[model samples]
Target: MSIPKTMKALVAYSATEYKYEPDYPTPQCGPDDIIIKTEGCGVCAGDLKCQHGAAMFWGDETQPSWVEPPFIPGHEFVGIIAEIGENVTGYKIGERVAADQIVPCGECRFCKDGHYWMCQPHQIFGFFSGLNGGMAEYVRLPKKAVIHKVPLEMPLNDGLLIEPYACSKHCVDRAKIEVEDIVVISGAGTLGLGMVTYAKLRSPKKLIVLDMMDERLEKAKEFGADLVWNPSKVNVTEEIMKLTDGYGCDVYIEATGHPSSVVQGMQMIRKLGRFVEFSVFGEPTTLDWSIIGDRKELDVLGSHLSPYCYPFVIENIANKTLKTNGIVSKSFAIEDWESAFDAATGKYRDFKVAIKF
Candidate 1:
């Protein structure tokens, strides 16, 4: 009953226009909604894409129409329950939690099929469709978004990584990667590195990471990549072929969404190999159709978001299997959000960054 009328948040709708203001109002709590006092939030690479006018808008193309501007945008967040709606009875006050940004309509066809990630009217929060993101003092979520009880074994601040972890887990699941399968990742940023870490758990016979940047390539090696390739310095295809004895990787996970990388990803695979496009592409890129569809008989795939990856991330963390806290190299406050974005996606940086609330 005592929620504040307005609070400060980072609001953006155009590339040249992002502002920090105190005008976001806590929404009227629906029966199933809970308010969260955000503790930490990440600035995903997709967040940077929105700023540079690459994110697609269903009806608006001229403007960088990400989420409705004037709305906060850090959906990758973790927090404590600040207020619970009358009908929300499961969560305790101050209970620690993280949530899914991709909120689904439970009655949709995909939801009926138990694939909520592909729901037709998929309402992603902190985008343009729903409440202010966690870049503020508090945020509200429907019970559907809440995934409670990350193990207390690891620092709760790292729980902001659950969303990104979900992405890698989905990729692993889709590829159906087998033990001893040779895997190659075509980017070593957070998502790519997450893939390296998680894919290794399946006991792959070989794992390699490819990147144009040496910093990322080195980071991949630190994460247990059997080999790391810098395309700037070596012929990636030749190296991969040599590693697999002219066979090819059983799986190629494309995490950068770069066109050139896609080309390499396809070429890096053996006949009948699977390539999961895990990155967010800025725009359409040309692919060699003859090679992609004809010769190689490749099984190219595109995974959007995770289905049930939250708990696994927590488990990985609790069990000391995955490293999220150490992967983050910088932190920025809500007021210094632009720098945080640049820091995370900036060319010289090789780590993830977050806006701590």
Candidate 2:
């Protein structure tokens, strides 16, 4: 097969914030690199946060790769290899795979110690200093970071959800949510809903989801949440405590990043219980230390992009343990990115947003 001289893509230009246009040239790859013709890409909330210059997108503009004005926005996508670079091993043209959006340099002390996820100089596919993402038609994958033999195909239009499921796997593992333990997930948005679905894998004593939107609340119950607690109507913390026999919850997963929810999260944790701050809050929020004072012993933890959760999520999806057919409400073509972005902002209980090419 002959390598095409140019391919179509979406590019971001400098000036204002990153904006998408109809077509940009597909990137070329060198040794140890591969290019994938995108099949689908998931619109991440972080992308929206990055666009408006939130804390989510860090690094200096002077250092370069600082959104670079006109860069593509997408870290989550699945596709087949379109081109392979010289010396790239273990991957064949036309193979189905998911490339690691972020690859930590192996030389880092943290990486050499088996904590590769924390590699000091991390290489990310979609966002960050260098390299392109999947929001466009083609993505370049470094040789060492390509994930193969993973299930990236779904009946035509559904494959875009694989990445979100990968995130769920990590949350479930880090949350340490035990079966028969009362778990309260304080957001029914995409990430919250994914966490809720993952929380149900174990037959917990009770699973409650808190969100302002009744539509999302309903979707939460549909996705296996034992109950829906709307802070708008009921006292969320008190209701959760009441459900746990008034002692409080064994686990609290805050996915909203909303300050009010964060404050409520500090209050919802039981004495000696675990509180996982998993939300991608766009702005800063204040939490009172007194919430964890005296009586309550809390394990406050944070989970960034799930690094060790790919295979598990893939297996579960293969075994029918994870259901994509349920929470996936809509998919938009990358051309309609404006609507796609709008849909990501807690609109109508969409557990996940998929973009098809």
The best candidate by TM-score is 1
Question: What does candidate 1's lDDT look like per residue over 117-176, in tens digits?
Answer: 887876676666365677777888886774656654557556767778878889877888
Consecutive 10-residue window with the lowest summed lDDT within model 2: 61-70
Return the top candidate by lDDT: 1
Give each model a TM-score: 0.92, 0.90
lDDT of 2 by residue, 1-357 (tens): 454555555555532345555546667787878888887787788776775566335445444344443467688888888788889777788887775556777888987897776677666666642577888877777756737455544453335556776676676667798875888888877667777777898777888899898988888888888889889999988887777777888888888878898788777778888888876765679866866766686888787766867766666666767655556677887778778777876565566677787
Runs with alpha carbons beyond 4 Å of true place in candidate 1: 1-3, 13-16, 58-66
Which residue pairs come into collision in candidate 1?
A: 68-128
Lowest lDDT 10-residue stretch of candidate 1 = 57-66
RMSD of each: 2.4, 2.7
265: Cα error in model 1, Å? 1.6
User: Model 2, stretches more than 4 Å misplaced?
Assistant: 1-3, 21-23, 55-70, 156-158
